[model samples]
Target: MINMHYTACSLLKITFKSLLTFFAREEREDTMPNTEPKLYKLQKKDLVACILRVFAKLVLFSFHRITMEGLEHLPKEGPALLLPKHCTYGRDVALEAIALHRATGRYANFLMRAIASRFYEWAGGIKIARPKDVRRVPGARALNRASFEYIRWLYLQGEVLVAHPEGTRNPYDMGALKMGVIKHLMDVENEAGRCIPLVPIGIRYRGYWVPFSRIEVKIGEPVYADDFENIKHLLSYLREQISQLSGWVI
Candidate 1:
């Protein structure tokens, strides 16, 4: 619920401005080792960086005729959070982000795993340590902490973060959400100086993993920081909204 389509004329005046000022705000994480990846640290996204975001959005729009819903419900300015169901089979994360920016002019900062180089930098990408097993990846513990710290920083800075609460993509399953997401919202609000808005998003595609297929992006009404007292309530509401949005019932 709480969605609409913007007209062509409006996009010309509002799109660029929204994208320009978006994610151009604050974030600060605890002290970390210099050896940790840059993703763990909070760095300002400059004007040039935002400009690149514009271009990136355009490319995504041109790539597919994505259908976006409920964009207007998102805050026009300042910080917000989106927990989008991840659809790895359909490239939902990238495609939805692109569609979201095209429709609403809002961009999401993400926690990315460190590679030699990556494509996520366009969206204020932060390098993180991702290890399914601690034995498999060196320095994963500290790096994971750093990534969480930076995520908290992004929320504090007034940037909307797009995250997969399930922590991984399972296109057909909307499993248990990560407890960290719940705790993050509760723990960081006091330091943020404001209660951040937490929104739920759902992405559905015409055909799973089909090339050039039509996709629908559903953005549900926000669940604000103070709306519920604990994680269970927030979690239940989020799952319900996403289930309705994506039609992925558990």
Candidate 2:
């Protein structure tokens, strides 16, 4: 009788353990959320737009020789801020856009000047309005908010964004860094509740007005959003990095 009782107890314990294991698996599955969102699945229309943009860039610019370094640094997936120093004549802008597209299989969205909206629209690029113009249009405040929301949306969708913190191109003189890029980074982090990586790019031109004179692009390490306390520190660090890489004294 004692042996029978012991066998029954062992069986009961085994049954309880099996039940606990099943419930534990079910609970784990319920708690593990999907981190990746399916927002960036490119539609047929997006592909067409990318093709057109590529064609335009190829036809419009006469790139004599382009050397890209640190291509391996670009992330294979996910959204990132592509920040490059702005040079005179808008060459850096074109280079940034093309390089990003080539490195990552996605078209780049730029935070363009208000006046360039029509041109960007024609080229099938996303246009972000300037602060001054927000006052002119009806419901401008809402539009401004919406534009940023769209930026975050694009990021969530796994698209690349190239922004020049210096609102205007510098003439290779004093390294005057602006806060626009840092502001965008902070805004994105605030909305996403996670720090996005920043990719620093350096574009060097051998000579101005000399086509095919040799363009060198160096993509530096990624900077996390939480690395710096504020935008000032971030901008200062970026400016220094670009200056050092480009061999320019700021």
Candidate 3:
């Protein structure tokens, strides 16, 4: 009789655990991000528009100057991840996109924070909630996973992906790098048995938010996932490279 009772209790516990696992998986599948969002298409007029935008920025801002260095470091044709320091809240995003397009002749897929803006949506930006905001934001973790999956798809397609690891714009000082993207890349590399190039870009502004701001973009040499023994080392190396290029102290 005691053996029968113990067996029943064990069965009940196993059933309960199985139900919990099932529900958790169902929830995960429901919250997974949709990876097939319409991406931006390049047009000949886009180049013209970029040129006009540069001209307008220079003419209106007057003292605004943009200098790009080490652009040749960007691969002419291949999959690369661009990690640029996020500085200004405005125009910096556009400037980086324009710079990448001009340098590589490719429209880069951006992994950015969640936004409802049409421009970002139209540009096919992959949106994920910040780490701190994930719990507060609904389905934030799933969205990040979906974004990573989309990025992997972009990688397999041999396209450039740009993600700002610093989370938010830091006008002067550098911010701590996030490991989520790096870890995701490592996982992908492991599964695919290949190394992905990670390009560090540093953008510095002398007078951010002012018309007299001097903007400089420095593109560092490509670092691969296999270059470092571990993710921490890779992150540290990336931070150092970016700090040097942006003229920001570690």
Candidate 4:
């Protein structure tokens, strides 16, 4: 009734050969470093970006009243992830990042779909391929590989990243938070670098489609990346925190 080979394999949790191969590949890719500068750093300044930032502020301040909490939770002297509940169809969700810059003087780079006629390279915003659909394009794999490196570099350099965990904006529920970002965060955490925070944010709006509306940004506790063994656990913690803060059910 006892097979020694089976016992050892079971103890090792190596049942699925395909899963093992996938994880092995992922682990190998995760530990490697990407040194490309263009992918990570902005080289030139764009005037249009300056105008847009100002315009965004004007609309945020003049058209809407913004309130925020949990200022103390932001990382004091290290890189951190600013995961916010994206207010779909409203530009005001970005006000949370702007607010971070105002409070700490650290610019938050948004991870967005590829944009042309956008801000300068120095605008601190990271642009990835469009549609953000990872499965349909051959170039998507390449883009994602480069982006992983760039994002890792950003966090190590004490930069703040503003990304939607839900991947795309959803006006209704928070939508399902994806695991890709969390996996990368785990990779970043295990490397030898400064500590960073994975922050969860919640945003609520009233009269959002109206010309002017009020928004409340609630910042919750930060989850240290190195503390989790798997991305699923990390994602669960994130969903719970965001749900608790925004009253949005998971």
Instruction: Give the TM-score comparing model 4 with the true structure, all chains together.
Output: 0.74
Cα lDDT of model 4 by residue, 53-99, tens digit = 55557545655567888877876667788888876632533466566
Q: Give the lDDT of residue 163 in candidate 4.
A: 79
lDDT digits (tens) for residues 1-250 of candidate 1: 0111223323433543464345334222322223443543445344444565555455445444577888776776777777888776224555555655665676667655454123234446655554463346566676666667777767766777766777777677777777665577677887655788888888876654333456678888887757877778888888878867887876
What lDDT does candidate 2 reach at residue 177? 71
Q: Candidate 4: deviation at residue 145, Å?
A: 1.0
The root-mean-square deviation over C-alpha atoms between each candidate and the true structure, in angstroms, is: 9.3, 23.2, 18.2, 17.6
Stronger candidate by TM-score (2 vs 3) = 3
Residues 204-240 of candidate 3: C-alpha lDDT, one tens digit per residue:
8876435545778899999887878888899999999
What TM-score would every model get versus the actual structure?
Answer: 0.71, 0.69, 0.75, 0.74
Worst 10 residues of 2 by lDDT: 27-36
lDDT of 2: 0.61
- Sorting all predicted structures by lDDT, with the top scorer first, yields 3, 4, 1, 2
**Prediction 4 global C-alpha lDDT:** 0.63
lDDT: worst 10-residue window of model 3: 23-32
Candidate numbers, best TM-score first, in rank order:
3, 4, 1, 2
For lDDT, candidate 1 versus 4, the one ahead is 4
